[model samples]
Target chain A: AQSVSQHNHHVILSEAASLELGCNYSYGGTVNLFWYVQYPGQHLQLLLKYFSGDPLVKGIKGFEAEFIKSKFSFNLRKPSVQWSDTAEYFCAVNARAGNMLTFGGGTRLMVKP
Target chain B: DVKVTQSSRYLVKRTGEKVFLECVQDMDHENMFWYRQDPGLGLRLIYFSYDVKMKEKGDIPEGYSVSREKKERFSLILESASTNQTSMYLCASRIRDRSYGYTFGSGTRLTVV
Candidate 1:
């Protein structure tokens, strides 16, 4: 079974601060990676994904993630964050052959205005 | 726009009561999933269906059952609700080929008293 681990449980940042959320997975096989964000009173929406291509992938809202296969990591990063970035972020992994996704414990990011 | 719709945004039920949560998708997705979200726990998969009437137990399916008689609809049932089961329930759908990420519903917050 594949499992995802997000070391950070909570993150607090000021406006315009740079942000990075760590995500690691334990799966030996080929996998698809994803980052989803859930804002207050909203549904989970895709942030970005890495299947096959360049290691770095850009997502909506000035966010991006880099898939480091050697380290089994796909960390989410942003050059600068805004107050609207306050939300719960999840990291998920899906094995190439399977349709199921295993999600991390999630990181609650609170950006202070 | 394509969407995954959860029937209710909030639900309250007593312990030992049979509770039903409905989900519908307009994207004609072949795969649907049920997940429960708790603080710090992120999202845990409860059940998933690949096609109509084909259900698969996910990571945590002990207290839950699911019905998928129609391709666009997936229902989660709690045989006997408990306070421990109080959490936000999310529904998601995706196409079969893994070309894209899942589309999630707004979620149903269920409180079992």
Candidate 2:
């Protein structure tokens, strides 16, 4: 079964701290990767996505993700996190095998002021 | 701008009641998906429709059914609500040919007691 795994369940960091949320998927074929974010009371919004081109994709809010085929990982990263970045982050993977996404358990990131 | 909207923001239902969650997208997307988000489960695919009147069961479709009567509308139906089924239900839409990534709704928080 294709599954997405997130290493950190919860992460707390001070403002200006570098942030990295690990995401790994277990699929042998070509896959599409995505990073989504949800604020305290808002909808889940797309942060970044990787389909074919560019292994590294930049997204809104200064977020970026790296898609590594050998590692089977598409990790979300930001040079610095702010208080508004405090939210839940989800990593998802999809393949032509099925259009459904396999999402990780999510990482709760809390950035302190 | 693309917008996905859920009919309800919060809902309370009895354990044996039938529940309907409605989702609509203004983007005229071809693929619409229903997902449930829980604490330990980031997002479990419940059902998806690739086109009007064409539906497919997703990973966790055992307790749910779906409807796609029109191009921009998809509905998730819980045959019989259970306590264990209480979770945040999200609806998403995407254009199949252009991009596989999704634009998600605000989500409906359902509570079954």
- Candidate DockQ scores, in order: 0.84, 0.71
lDDT score for residue A66 of model 1: 97
Q: In model 2, how well does chain A match by TM-score?
A: 0.98
Q: For model 1, state the Cα shift of residue A52 in Å.
A: 0.2
Task: Give me the displacement of residue A13 in model 1, in angstroms.
Answer: 0.8
Question: Model 1 over residues B31-110: C-alpha lDDT tens digits?
Answer: 99999999988899999999999999999999999999999999999999999999999999999977579999999999
lDDT of 2 by residue, A53-103 (tens): 999999999999999999999999999999999999999988866777789
User: Could you give candidate 2's per-residue lDDT for residues B1-113 as a string of tens digits?
Assistant: 89999999999999999999999999889999999999977999999899999998888898899889999999999999999999999999999853467889999999999
- Residue pairs with backbone overlap in model 1: none
Off by over 4 Å in 1: none
TM-score for model 2?
A: 0.96
